[model samples]
Target chain A: MSIKLTIMDEMARVAREHGKILAPLDDDLALLDCGLDSLGIAVLVARLEDKLGLDPFTTAEEVQFPVTVGDFVKAYEHGAH
Target chain B: MSTALTDAQPLRARLTGATADAVFFDRAARVRVADLVCRTSLCGGRADLGGRAVLLVTASQLTAALALIELDGMVRRLLILPPDVDPDHLGALIAGAEIDAVVTDGTLPPQLAGLPVRVVCTPGIVPLAEPPRACERTEWVLLTSGTTGVPKMVAHSVAGLTAALAPSASAEPVVWGTFYDIRRYGGLQIFLRAVLGGASLVLSSAGEPVAEHLARLARHGVTHLSGTPSHWRRALMSPEIGRIAPRYVRLSGEIADQAILDALRAAFPRADIGHAYASTEAGVVFAVDDGRAGFPARFLNGARNGVEIKIVDGCLRIRSPGAALRYVGGAKTAALHDGDGFVDSGDMVERQGDRYVFVGRQGGIINVGGLKVHPEEVEAVINRHPRVRMSLVRAKRSPFTGALVVADIVLTAPAAAAGNEAELRDDILKLCRGALPRHKVPAAISFVPALAVAATGKLARRGV
Candidate 1:
């Protein structure tokens, strides 16, 4: 699967298991405005790190946290490249 | 004047006529009573805060802070504010307490600059004025380690606080050290004990690495050292633990689990390693010196010195002449005490064979090391996220800190579908980091379908 697809799938799984998402997934959505919280986000990151074998937040020398869904995906994409 | 008024000696009477040299030693300098007296007189005169509410921001300079405390005791109602407190929160505290002056070491936060309180920055002597007469009833207002909301101000009289302290055992003045800062209750107890006993104190600097702190204690030949279990754990982890050979080692602030007690015994076989049960409200309750985790069960309803202890419905209750008079600006004295005057300690104890062990807090407060963290406070912050339906904060056992904070969160459906949980978590953490102190930050975050609620319509905290 593509990195974007994998990240999305993990996010959906975490959300479905913990809380319900009333709207459609999109890049423009502010992550904080979404239903997920810090713990849910942490689970998603751990899943992504497991599959991709890279955690951008932990491995990066200086990590600027991504505020939006698009920026988050971009962070993973940059790390992958 | 009443007999009590005439009988009450000035608070400075504790420090009067001590041997003129090496009274307080830190990494940088040695302070004498004469030096302290002169400085105190100069500060008292310069600040001229006569019987006003004075907020003391120690900023972890133990020597200067102690001197300021001595001065405040003489002429002002001292409010000891922790050095690590958030500046904005501190401003609220200062305003709430109606502080008239501030004595600090040149590091006052910008938020407090505009306050009407007189600011006396330390290490410089101002021109001296005639010293004012000390009050017969000097109040020392301390802030409770608020885990849920704003910290409460607890008022204690100087005489009542020092009433229970035992005189120094040895004729030769001993050297004392503690892991707590002078602003904190536990550290203040040690400071008062050292002063009342006529011993010199080695004050630990805040934010100094544990290895360096331990090295300093060793270099200064600290004979009696006291710390929380967490502090000891950090000290044990340090490579320089072998440097200090104290004659007495004490543990307080957190539950003294068997593992920590055994570790201390192994580390300091010759030292009298003991753990004490004490609180800001209850003063020093009891000390267990048997290298055990819990006190004997028989201590219930037992009187030690002047303090009495008993367990009420699994909660430890204490009645002492030295107990804090009342929580200032908050709860009344009646609300905290029983009909007979025993203060509800808010700590839950469990019966373990012949001993009673402290399990945790009954009031849903999480103790991370010796510091208190309220779950409601963290939950309130997490619930602010637009997508979050609710959040539950709890403590998980940790080796580094005694307990690590973890948050379980429930999200809104649309946000869940967005599949951006990682980013959401980071954002939430950032929000908490910006708002809460470092120790109050949640170490781990996890997603939950729902938070359990009790049958009585309250959030269920059992088995967390």
Candidate 2:
């Protein structure tokens, strides 16, 4: 699966587990507006790390915390490359 | 005990008005205090194991307690070994403490096979033909918990251990209970308290279920209870928490945060909630009984004997009469206290408003992007959430930051949280964000069925 799809799927699963629904998985959606809380985001990051076998926060020379869904996907994509 | 050990004086000669109420209870049997006046812990083997460094390894705390009472003024030095000591460190501890005799409960572990003398205690009240007589003042040795390889053995005089315990006035029948094994420092304090007050003590086994333990305590009508915050947190989660409504609830061996204090207050409405600040190396420090989190800043004002406190490099240092006298065995250095006679307790604290609240251990900080995060600080914040039953904040290795703060938490109600994990997680995150610094917030939080509490009744910290 693609990194973006994998991230979105895990986010949805985590939200369901938390008894909440996701707002939307659009690339332009700000992370703060996502149905996930910071703990949910953290759980998503851990899940993505297990699924993708890479952590952009650990691999990339310089990294910034993502502001949007697109930025998170791009960071993972860049680290994978 | 400082006066001098006499042939006529046993340890309990200090307790004057002892009626027939005091007894020690385990799961299997019970021994009354009045019956113990004539009987010896080592019933038959007391003759062979006299006047030497005696290592006591008991299967039951009941035996350990009775043996201590009998061995106080009879032997040269008596080391009470907790059942959970690492076997690898046994050889060194035996040789270092110069253990020539051992008092055990019928069975001896293979590690202690080479000891010169082994006496088996049955926790019975049978009179011995020739009971061990008091000769030398027995120095009591205890082991400090070791995170790495081996624990240090601390030596204390009988005078030192009982310095802070004032004899209980004959007011009401006070039956005591503890989650701690009687061999450890905290539990030993409670044992001494029971002995001093001529009261009964309900002992806890190592791996006993919380419900069964609570039921047993209720059966005994336990009135005074003491344990670590971790023990109380796990106990509060059980439905059997209402079984025994203790008149006094005490917490020690860890920092007592605001959340646990409040929880105990609400659960036991009529009980007086108190958390004592006692160090293993340092003696018993001051206790906070005002239902507050940390002690008042004014506690540091007076330079008294047992209550003296000084903050050197943020670590709380104390000089008290209740501390360990010296380090036994040659495993470590000779100094139990500092040059100024103060035991430097490695707990760090911060002055917030009118109180000095604990942050974390001095060597227990997580360096996250050059910012120090105290695990206890994060744990205190995480526990404030209503959904959290218990939380252990730990450092997870991270290449981005030196170490990332992560938390493993147990839910107060697992069945009630089937689909409501997201809201609870959100509430916890919001609480942490408001209370803790950004770096101190957990990078990841996982809901575990239960957190592993050590044999010391503390939240076990796994390797980072």
Candidate 3:
């Protein structure tokens, strides 16, 4: 799957788990950030690994910027490649 | 006079004993067993105080017996110990204090032989008499700022120490856990609470792995755990605590951050997470809700259990039921309180609502061009970053900032994925710049696999 699709799916999973409306790809992941503290990221990262063969952002540092959903997706896609 | 068995009961039994006068079992059974082993091995040739007095050198069994014997009226007087304590110093103290008899373990230096001293290895050997009259003026001395700088001998009294612990809203049996040695004030409170409140006590083994200690707590059904921020962080990092939840986690002996407190609360949702400010010189003065971490403490508004608090010179002082007494064998210093006898240990405060919050120790504040920077404030920001797991903040001599703040951090395992130390450092610095104020930002950041803590499992102030 493409990195964009993978990122979108992962964000959707987080949104579903947190019971929040999913934001657009270009929107910030504020909905997930509500519950996506460090531990939440660990869960998200694990899900990303299962869906996409390539992992995004070699470390937690890559996912540091959650300012917008698009930024998270771009970062993840860049890392997965 | 009470005999051996009565002195050996569990803390609960002891607390309930006065009313029940029932069978008592000393909770420190291991120490008693060790003493028995020693007696059997030595063929009982050691000095036996029998019913006279026992001197304790450490809070361990050998010394615990001394405490018990003195309490039970088996001994006329008791002497607790500080390791490598000088005999001449103790002799002079006893002479000045006019204490006649001293019962101790047989490990005293030769110079102490002149005094009437009995060596006791077990609490069973010491007989008990009527409890001594509550000292109208008793002092419990704490030797803090040891050797690193001019060591100050701080003195508080039995009444003062007891007065320091404000009553808690929760009456459920208090479960106490700490890495601190009972010799210090922080750990001493746990001992006192367990003994006085008849609470269950789970003593963390010295030098045990944080994972192992958390596992031990689960196995023992511990409900309350207390430690410094470093200790709690380590325990949280352990997979065991993530699975094993306690009812209460208290951070004391140092400052804490919201991130750590939030993490702990999530890990143990049923637990009430809180922190308190205490020192060897001043007993526990204030406590705040778990959410109050990273901020200055909100002092208890109304006196609880006869505890009192006041801020003097921007320093928070407390007088509680569990405060300590005066110093002995060290330079005589004034007690912790002011004229009203309220204990103040030089903790800086910020008034928040009706209650006061502790910002930092007065001497511990770092002046960056007159912009006061508390290391804990900066450290809280550093610890909030996702990459950072644990950190220590201390002031360094800097020509530019006068006293520059430095953050030494231990990155989380995932943070190490950033490739190199430089990458992690940049990430941490960037986070600090974005989250903290310009002045509060750390002047220098050092990344390490772990931060060094003291023997008592507290972050060393120097951040060595």
Candidate 4:
């Protein structure tokens, strides 16, 4: 099943906060790279942790993913269970 | 930062008093609090508890309380664990060790649903409890392997530890920064030195952001920074290194070379970049800083008798005041021991005139077939280049060669400058071939923007 739109919105909010423009979720998520640096990704993960109340990404490799907003939402949704 | 007067009078006086209330743990205000803890523990009835009565809380407030316990003579044992440790493991360890009373934030270990030890959850309440006396020497125990493998308890004495701290040179007030776990010995030294000197301790919010850490140094006006060679290299590569500066930079827990020293000097022109040599078992050995990259002649030409260092069988042997009593259960015995007292660290060394330089750990020297290849030796060659910021050389399994040297590099310049992966590969290979020995040269190179540095700013060599 696909992720909820609310997750996409929150992901977008995080991307925007990190000074990245998020493409629409309808597009291929992998195509839209937000170019989030380490600190930016850290902020995104922290926000997601607070929002989801779960530590989704612990390792550096996991955090390096979600190059784009759509990719982030998808990853979060996939791991939501 | 500021050595402002505490709300109370001088700490020595309160420590001497029958009843004294003071802040026990503070990352920022360590020296004052440590001094207070040391004084009170020594004078008060609790002096005997040494490591046992002391309930070491991971939180700054709890650490403060533990410091007070250390002073009050109430602490009979010390349970050293990081704030982030698994509560289940902590409780199990505490229970297995039979900790008398726990001084924690009432955060019960998941495994410790119900324990017999009295729990002191609040700092406000710790002071109110009847003054617990000091614990016995046999009670001083530290977690065996840390987060790795199974955890065991290693016992130490207060006099042994106090003796450990006393032999080292007195620390001057400086900002103490590190990337190692606070629970680990490496991290504890930084904490100990800061508490001893009362310096501001700047912890990394973002793990080892060398640039960000340097900025924090500027923000907090931190004077002293400590870490492994890898950490120092990160700080050197940090764009902020050229921008902000620290007063003193110390490299420890690993071998440091000229390349790292040169890079740090380039980054912090005004700072005193040096080496602080020590081990987990050996508390604080002699530190070598020649105001340049290589080792110095015992700081002042073997002037201090507290630490005596020599090279035997091409290995570094040292006897110092801060050396540990003995390893509890480790296979390795007193390294390079003379009949009388001195201990060898099982590390090879090269003598360049008076100063002795560390070559590599005896255990780590990789045997590629028969030729011995030290990882640091290969790393130093690669790191000498201006574009290469950091390099980790490790032996990789190879079907043809048995084991070939592999280097993972982080560049100071953009990766695209080499045009593409193939070209970058060729260029680096050519550079290594021309500069290094056949066996010493890396067979494979992976250009990464940054290498994975552990929290204590040391290179993570295991997974790589």
Candidate 5:
């Protein structure tokens, strides 16, 4: 499965658990500006790392933190590769 | 009798004659009290800082700072400056306090060089002069952690400060260990208690790695260990944690969460794990020994263990002899205290069944890994950016650091028109990096539509 799809699935799972309804994933949408709070972001990251086996957010030294869904997906893709 | 005459006894008088050989071991060297006293006296006399403020720059050498503190009445005041203090901040502190001399183990930093003050090195022997008159007015000025902007200077009389401490329960001498800088309040309390109890302290160097420091504590057979919960958390992560077996373990400087407390108890089954509620303003408050997270709620409105704990409007208020007399440099203590003289501890608490647990700061201060960071202070800096309209700073839960700093910003109309959030975030981060300390800088920045203000007409602080 692609990193983008995996991240969307994790976000969906987190939103479901938190009872938060997430809008459909879009590249330009800011992740934080969405329904996901910091806790939700953390949970999504953890779950994605479990399924996809890489977390660029934690591993990269001088990471420019992802602001949008596209950047978030790209970070995981870069780490996995 | 006059207060000065009654309280002006030499600090050395507290030490027993038989314990003259008790050692203070640091990473560099070990020195006995007998030798340290003689050397400090010599250095004190030659420096000739007769009744003037002297800045004692300490660099992980607890004994050296202790020796200078032992010269209680010889100097007017001793401002204990930590090694990692920002040079600009140090200069401001010195100038604000009107420091006349500096006594340090090593060379003075370049920021302090141009100041018109006498510089003297410690642990050096010089020709001794007649001992200076014992002035009881000698005060020890400690700098606050300065999580806000500039560190506040807190002045405490030696007599009053020592009077506030609880007497050591142990009759036999025990080896002590602490993860606090000797200059700060938590570390200073342990340092003073260990010395007065005639115990040997294995001083941990701030510059050393956690593993090496824990190894030294194990080698010294440290029986009593005190540190912040963050410190304990880091120590527990180190493999060397198993090497040291402390009989008494204390957690202070941060809220002692249950997980950390439980982990500590499991790690050292034989140790008495307890957490004490203390602040730089209000000295040592009550300590909870149930190996739990918070103190019993009954402690409120009741005097237990000779200390009074009261809850006034959901804020923890304490009245202790160890509480600081007043804030120096015209900072008002009126707002910090009530009409009845109880200090507002700035900590908000909630009753969890029979026990009271710390929720967060009522003052909107973000406690990032035991260091207090005022959100307003960070927000003020972020808002100063030309492109920024306003900012909301908050604490984010971090596994490594107890809490990490994060900021959400609202950009100005002109800047928002640029449509480059990434570049704007980087610019704000760079601006903060230059103005604030590394820890105070926001770990992550997010752009938001608007910051919410509560009905009380203040920025709503979201509790972690």
Candidate 6:
């Protein structure tokens, strides 16, 4: 699976576990509007860290805050380089 | 007047009794207290280790207990060396504590090759031609597990060490057991409880399995049990925990969360469960026995038997005769007390309505963003999960918030194998979400087989 799918799957899983009804996973969908809070985002990052064997937020030099789902996925994809 | 006990008198006078029964035990030997009052030596022949600074590095805690009973007022200073002290720093400890003589189990580590005067302490007694004469006073020097470098050595008078211990409440012979080595402060408190409180004590052996230790405690009819919450958590997880029926259970060295307290209550329905607030430097501050987590606010009332307490900027400060006099050799972080004589315990506390809840230590804070989270605080919430056995919350370096809270948790045996661990994780996370603020809640938790508890019987709060 591409890193984007993996991130999307984990986001859905974490949101489901948190009982948050996530908005449609459009690239332009704002992360805050996806019904996930900081804790959910944290869990998503942690699950990604486990599955991907890396935490882009920790590894990337001065990674920007992801305002949208596409930005979050791009950060991880950029780190994969 | 309390006969055979008061700390003001010499241990030679205190251990004198008509009883022939053994008062201390280990995996190998049993020793009587009153018998030690008479002229004798465990090292064979006469040991001239009196009226001078003495280093007690006995391999066996039983032997250490014996040394303590025999040399209380007979030595100018008695320094207890726990098994975990850095050998490289042994020479420094020797000079810092003014240790001139050594007592050991004949296996002195290479660190002590410099000390010429040595007495080998084994199990059996040697017929003594004459007992070592008593000194005017003996200062008990205990090494505090300092933050870094060589541990700081603190001096305590016999009265100071025993001031927190209550007199024998009754003559009933309740054999005591602890999961602590008799060298550290927590262990020494139990040692003093057994000896001065007029009770038999079964000592813990290092590396012994929880089941085996519990069985041994059962074999000896251990009724009063004491240890840190970490020790008790490990013991409670063992199937053999049911083997021993204790009348009293005590926790110290770490904050006793409501989860462990409630678990202990369920495990031993009839046992009197209590936890105390004490430190290596501050001695014992107080004990709470109401089957509660934090202590009642009333403990802050007027002086209770000369022990004064005040909270200065969220830290608990205690002033008592039981507090250690001063740190020997002026090691860094050895500012033992303020000019007002209050030893500032670095333990942080928060007032919760009518109770004082211990948050965590001053230096143990985990910063998440701009907010502070105590690992113990996060762990206390996670441990409340029904399937959780124990948890260790810690910090993970995070580019997002400088540092993020993470937890390594051990689940109950059944839950571990049930294989629905994902659900348990979600359940635990939900618990954290409910009880904790966003920053204090763990960002993630990893299921672990076990958490490492240090020799100090505390959850080793280091990187996972």
Highest TM-score, which number?
6
lDDT per residue (tens digit) for residues A19-47 in model 1: 45824768988876566665556556655
- Candidate 5 per-residue lDDT, tens place, B1-464, comes to 11355744656555553265466778876756555444452343444666777788756465455545455776777788865566777766877777877766667778778655654555444333443456546778877654445677877777556655667777666888888777788888777777677778888665688899999999988999998765775677678999999999998886676666777888999889889888878778878899988788788756665568788777888887777777665344445457777888888787879998886567676666577776655775676686665567887655334566788876655344466876786678778868786667776677876666421113456765
Query: Native-vs-model 2 lDDT?
Result: 0.82
* TM-score quality measure for candidate 6: 0.92
True contacts kept of 3: 0.00
Tell me the DockQ of each model, to 2 decimals. 0.04, 0.16, 0.02, 0.01, 0.04, 0.40
Candidate number with the higher lDDT (1 or 3)? 1
Model 1: DockQ score: 0.04
Residue B115's lDDT in candidate 3:
58
Binned by DockQ into CAPRI classes (incorrect, acceptable, medium, high), candidate 4 is incorrect
What TM-score against the true fold does each predicted structure earn? 0.66, 0.88, 0.65, 0.65, 0.69, 0.92
Q: List candidate 6 segments past 4 Å from native.
A: A9-43, A60-71, A78-81, B1-7, B44-47, B414-418
Worst 10 residues of 2 chain B by lDDT: B1-10
Q: Write the per-residue lDDT of candidate 6 for residues B213-255, one digit (tens) a residue.
A: 8998999999899999999999998889989989999999899
Write down the RMSD of all candidates, one decimal each: 13.2, 5.2, 13.1, 15.2, 13.0, 3.5
Candidate 2 global Cα RMSD: 5.2
lDDT per model, in order? 0.69, 0.82, 0.56, 0.55, 0.70, 0.82
Give per-residue CA lDDT, model 1, range B163-282, as digits (tens). Answer: 677776676557889887657777788888776676788876655677888999888888899987656755776789999999899998766666567667878889998888888888
User: How would you encode candidate 2's per-residue C-alpha lDDT over B41-152 as one tens digit per residue?
Assistant: 6657687766778998888888888888888777888888988898898998988998999998867779888887888887766875654456777788999876777788
Judge the docking of candidate 2 as incorrect, acceptable, medium or high.
Answer: incorrect
Span of 10 residues, lowest total lDDT, candidate 1 chain B: B453-462
Candidate 6 chain B lowest-lDDT run of ten: B1-10
Pull out the clashing pairs in model 5.
none
From the highest TM-score down, the ranking of the candidates is 6, 2, 5, 1, 3, 4
